[model samples]
Target chain A: MSEDHVPGFNTLSIHAGAQPDPTTGARATPIYQTTSFVFEDVDHAASLFGLQAFGNIYTRIGNPTCAVLEERVAALEGGTAALAVASGHAAQLIVMHTLLQPGDEFIAGTQLYGGSINQFNHAFKKFDWHVAWADSTDVSSFEKAVTPKTKAIFIESVANPGGVVVDIEGIAQVARRAGVPLIVDNTLASPYLCRPFEHGADIVVHSATKFLGGHGNSIGGVIVDGGTFNWMREGRYPTLSEPCESYQGMVLGETFGNFAFAIACRVLGLRDLGAALSPFNAFLLVTGIETLSLRMDRHCANAVAVAEFLSSHPKVAWVSYSGLPGDRYHALQQKYCPKGGGAVFTFGVKGGYDAGVKVVSNVQLFSHLANIGDTRSLIIHPASTTHRQLSDQQKTSAGAGPDVIRVSIGIEDKEDIIADLDQALASA
Target chain B: MNHDSYPDAYIREILDSCRVIAMVGASANTVRPSYFVLKYMLEKGYRVIPVNPGQAGKDILGQRVYASLSDIPEPIDMVDIFRASEAADGIVDEALALEPRPKVIWMQLSVRNDEAAAKAEAAGLKVVMNRCPKIEYGRLSGEIAWAGVNRRTVSSKRPVLSGGGFQRLGLGKGRTSN
Candidate 1:
């Protein structure tokens, strides 16, 4: 009832940007399963198109269903605005597209999702947008990677496959000094564990397909604008600072202050790139988010138990779960994700690649697939699947080495999860 | 006066009750934020007096533009500062000096001056900083949801179209309208 009363994480996850349906009185966020919305008049239509008013013209750019998800995630992340998109790759692409020009570059931590490393090193190069790789653990490496051509710095809150908890604050300082926005892929931590914005990230990205849509039934991503970066000052990001040619020459930075980046991505990137999240997927993702805190709590607790079980196993050569006290990232895990080490972590098999494949084949309860952050336990030999495109050195740097087996611990009882892993390890 | 956050009631009361608004540093450029915001308020049926030294005695969106807040002949209900933070200090002083001074001092987005806000609050004026009124009006009115922005309030109330061709659910508390 009071505006001063800010909503808590769990409360916002359920109701942040939603209201009962005005026309139909639907209680749950009904999928407004339409491609376009009708305008009030010609003037209204012009205003909506000209950016003079806030109204939906097409589902490609904005939708009521997607808007609620955007708002919920934004509130959870402590960001000003957010854009919901098709996938994590789409979110990354839209963000980079908005920030970089043909020759411009961005710095990314080497310890990232294998797909992201591929996207940065291979896919982004087609646009002539270069990515300078830096070590996620070493903050100085980010500073050294920054060149005059650098427009942004990218890192994962918790590196995928590797289970490395990055020093976001340390790297954020490097980003601040370089006068670029720090883009953190918070796919694993899921706001319940690590809020990148709280630690000085300028923009927070999520692969909602994983933890956010806990059921693994949907594929969606979100880009939350922290509203901290100034895009207009030096004319560095012309997409925001300069007059937009397509949209009545409205300089988005001046027109939509604080939330300008989100607007720019929506009007420029999503509007053009055409990778949009379906309303049904958005509804499922939002529903999945309702129990995010509950699922994440159980997932982390089970993960620690699984990590402990694997670390003591004779068949395991080494484990990379930050939840373990002896693990190298324990201190950082404490600092950033005190909740637990997170749901996913990796361990090396004694016999390397062949043994890892055997473990995947032997697991019964854990689904051997290429995904994380699902309510169901998933196992993958990333070297043979997700990271197969990368070179051997690149695979090791990404924590997807030939010997590594990654498991996404589920909300299921710990005993069942550990038994499955135990039987799988024995066979290996 | 914590400018960090504003209660929904505090903002709603100002938008619903304050009828006349004087937009300081109002721009003529159509793409500028001040221009569209003024247009939005005008269309929302509020009497908005544009204050700009560069374009005086002319009209902005058909409202007679005044050189300053002091030059406006009629009583002003609120002074929306669209200028930089440094310029808001002088505008607040000017608003405070006016006879029957305005009830509210609203600074536009990205404009924050704590000292000026404190000074204005000392004079019994309500202050809102680093926010957009058009955004708030649309938000409180629940019309911003039309554009995919988070309206932040959930309610059972349905929207009713106004004579001016817009829906005003008003604030979320079931209080119909001003």
Candidate 2:
């Protein structure tokens, strides 16, 4: 099928990168649950290995089912191409590895997920990739943070747990001025809430383990290339701009045109890093994506209701959901995620730590799991868990406080959620 | 019920004595209560550990910001939490798994988990719920200068109209009470 004939979100999610099985006419995408594909002859095998032609070389690099996921996600995100990986962390690593070398730096929002903060602060430092933290609310801070060594500017469209929305276009303008690409983690917002590409992001990434998968069953990640960044124009990104011995000296930008960075990510990053998503997980994620629009609509509506409930609750000290009019990021959310503010938010309980704990204990519906973006409502206390690794000062900076509780609102009935929360707050 | 059925007294003691805690959620941004309370705690000298993942390994209030409680490498008497409730279990588990478990698992004002609290209590730990140690400490230790019942005189002086009232303060008048 051609791009023009491709259908809506629900249709494309199921059939975007797949067709009926050529041999058996199977309606569903089959999990190519094999390590390697066999070649017909020696030359054909050599061509596959040499990247002279496209064929599955190893599951570590790519798989047929995972390819369908990548394609479907790319289409959903309005990107030229995408790569599915083992986890959201791996997706980030792949993008960074392809974009940065030792001594290269990236500017990132301070309001990112706590794990991402740790990755950028400590893990990425191991690779000598420095990250300058920028206040997502302040675009000028991003501009000031950029230097000659800066390769990318990264932000989360709707920051995890924090629920702060980034000004993608404003920051993208900064990246463009600095001759670098802007990468937005669209995990919390998802393509359903906001397509980062539409607002000027050069690339979008997701921890498909969350909303994209809908259920809390699988862990996966995806990187979508918006094909907006001009790698060759300024020669800032040599990995894509220059020729490579990795693929027989093929200059990615010259060969792949707009999708050069994404091709580089697959051929170089995923190939070397070996963080390929499993075919089974890919299939699950695809099924989840098929209901993305529906789930997101409900998620947003439920989240707004929950946020309002929390904000009004006497026990809630503060609520930080972009859907709320008083939220600091509400304006940015309106500009970026006009569809809806997303399904995650943070609120402080009135009694501080004890009240926070009491509410968690009293809640019957919300799952007390370590993961988010589940179809079922999820909640966590960051100061005690996810952000526990950080010191008191660090926790405050990350917006995880002793009194704060984070919620990843699900697509359940809003009334049920509010009722549960009301009882929990009353009990607390 | 047996005497053991009662919660541990050590937990109560830790919760009572630990004032001026450096809650990692202690914000430097004044608008953020974390900042005010952290400053309040610091002024009170109970020792605050600001645990922000973003600022981990950085300095907050002249204190080194460690990532996790275990990473603190020092004797932290209490683990006052500000994370989500789902995250509490893992943190409690981690705290229990520590070489020396924290004296109290103080779930922030609105945070709570009975299973986690029970787990900690089962492991000879103290659990406090629906309370801010800072406020309690202030109220109990005479740190709060105001004279009032339940500290409402000082704390409630700022008339935050409930959700049901007419829009005098931008908040509803009396529909909801906190």
Candidate 3:
């Protein structure tokens, strides 16, 4: 890599955040596992604490290993800065904490991960924050739901459980009109597949536990600040606009300029909330992201084959994969994620709930687990598992009807993955 | 943006120096968080003027409600916003247009607007976003320790419960035994 030559996505994935370790020249990002960093001198410590210089003070605030992961993801997503947290949920929490005030409201797409629905519907209410549900399929619903109190609009890039591709640009326009930031959960369609920021999203969150980690070994989340939203434009976000009491009258937005939101999340939200990502997890995620482009391509190809097989199968009542031609979200898939509609998709079995359970239990190669983005195929009956907490109507709206079976196609042989599903459906 | 965290010493400096506040987006509803925070600030000796277009000509927490920040007669030291994050921009613009202008713009907990904060700071105003002054007062006065939220400061001393009641801790430094 050189200053003159621009690196491609694959090259940047491996080299963007990393340089030869200054101390030991280690090619791999060394896990700075300890809790604190040594200061050069009294002035250096003062400078760091005073925001006069940039350096690690503690693992809870920042770390070398984690910094690399953050930089890599930021580069991958075309964002100014990124903050890594304990899990995908933690990332959303910090982001909302930075944006939503008690009694403030935000609009959310009805079609979201079951866990996200729980977090927004039940948990966010505890903070006095309200959520207005909107239909992702109908962009006008989002525009209609905007109120003077609406702070943000949230949607998943390729909605979980079902492979429904969202119209990111349409919703982004609505957010723009309402003077709110558009937050996109890019967990399913990693940057290799869809870059939400490029389309109009101001912030992108990832369940690094999924595609970014690729291996499913580490639980991590990331927030990429697109650095596009004008926090000072309307004075809507006082957290970034005003002097933080936590730090003497230092105004984060005024001081940090474009990416002040990220800084606030780090100093204020993460500092107080304590959902810091471990250095070991950062190291593992960095390694996994290195092969993201390669794995994602295979994942998409395998998923298309599996979806086609399922659509024609006698046991499957319907298949909801955007990759398939004539699917409802096929045009959206072409517009948003031109490369692929991602590996995850949903299909309803003819035998309903009982058959859904049988198919999940009968799978051999595809592990029946509460996870996705694994190198190995995975399956789940969401009605009885991931979406169990949701109401019946919620389950249906989220495309997790009782008969729906979700699959995360992996980078395995297309025939093997299809064969596994064939046997499972036969048993059902 | 990486200006870093502000220490407790600075926080104390700002709190110690500030006085009269004009609350933007103040609501008349008793259950609203803005109403309670306004009530708390008023009880703390800070003269607070509630600003809400809908509540204009009415009284909330004993203060006459004004339609906007500019309509308030007195020179306000701080403008505490109780509105949504998107509303802060226009409020900041209005605050900046005032003759003396507010010395500080404090957004309630979870309200943050980076752009508005920058403009205010550039014009020599201090801004605090996504925080509650009532919560800060309680934590700084060592009054919230009973609920176990103030981790930055740890004192073995038990907090004094004011005669006015424990809930009034958001008011001032009167409740702490320390």
Per-prediction TM-score: 0.94, 0.69, 0.71
How would you encode candidate 3's per-residue C-alpha lDDT over A1-428 as one tens digit per residue? Answer: 22124567887788756654534667777898989877767755764565434457788888878877887888788886788899999999999999999999999998899999999999999999999999999999999999999999999999998888999999999999999999999999999999999999999999999999999899999998898998876778999887677666676785554566777888888889999999999999999999999999999999999999999999999999999999999999999898999999999999899999999999999999999999999999999999998889999999999999999999989999999999989989
The DockQ scores of all candidates, in the order shown, are 0.45, 0.01, 0.02
Interface RMSD, candidates in the order listed: 3.3, 30.9, 20.2
Ranking by DockQ: 1, 3, 2
lDDT of 2 by residue, A1-428 (tens): 22123366666565556544433556677777989766646754664465433445678877767877787788788887788899999999999999998999999988879999999999999999999999988999998998989999999988876778888899989998998889999999888778888888998999999999999999999998887888887777788877776665566675554566777888889889889888899889988888888888999999988888787777788889888887888888888888899888899998887778787888899988778889899988888889989879878877888998998888888999999889988998
Judged by DockQ relative to the true structure, which candidate is superior, 1 or 3?
Answer: 1
Candidate 1 or 2, higher TM-score? 1
How well does candidate 1 match the true structure, expressed as C-alpha RMSD?
A: 2.4
**After superposition, which runs of candidate 1 have C-alpha atoms over 4 Å from their true positions?**
B89-100, B112-122, B145-169, B172-178
Q: Please, what are the lDDT tens digits per residue for candidate 1 over residues B1-178?
A: 6688787778888887889999999999888889999988876778999999999999988889999999999999999999989998999999999999999999998899988999999999999999999989887777766444555554445544444443333443447422
Model 3 misplaced stretches (Cα beyond 4 Å): B1-178
> Judged by TM-score, which candidate is best?
1
Q: How accurate is candidate 2 locally (lDDT)?
A: 0.74
lDDT of each: 0.88, 0.74, 0.82
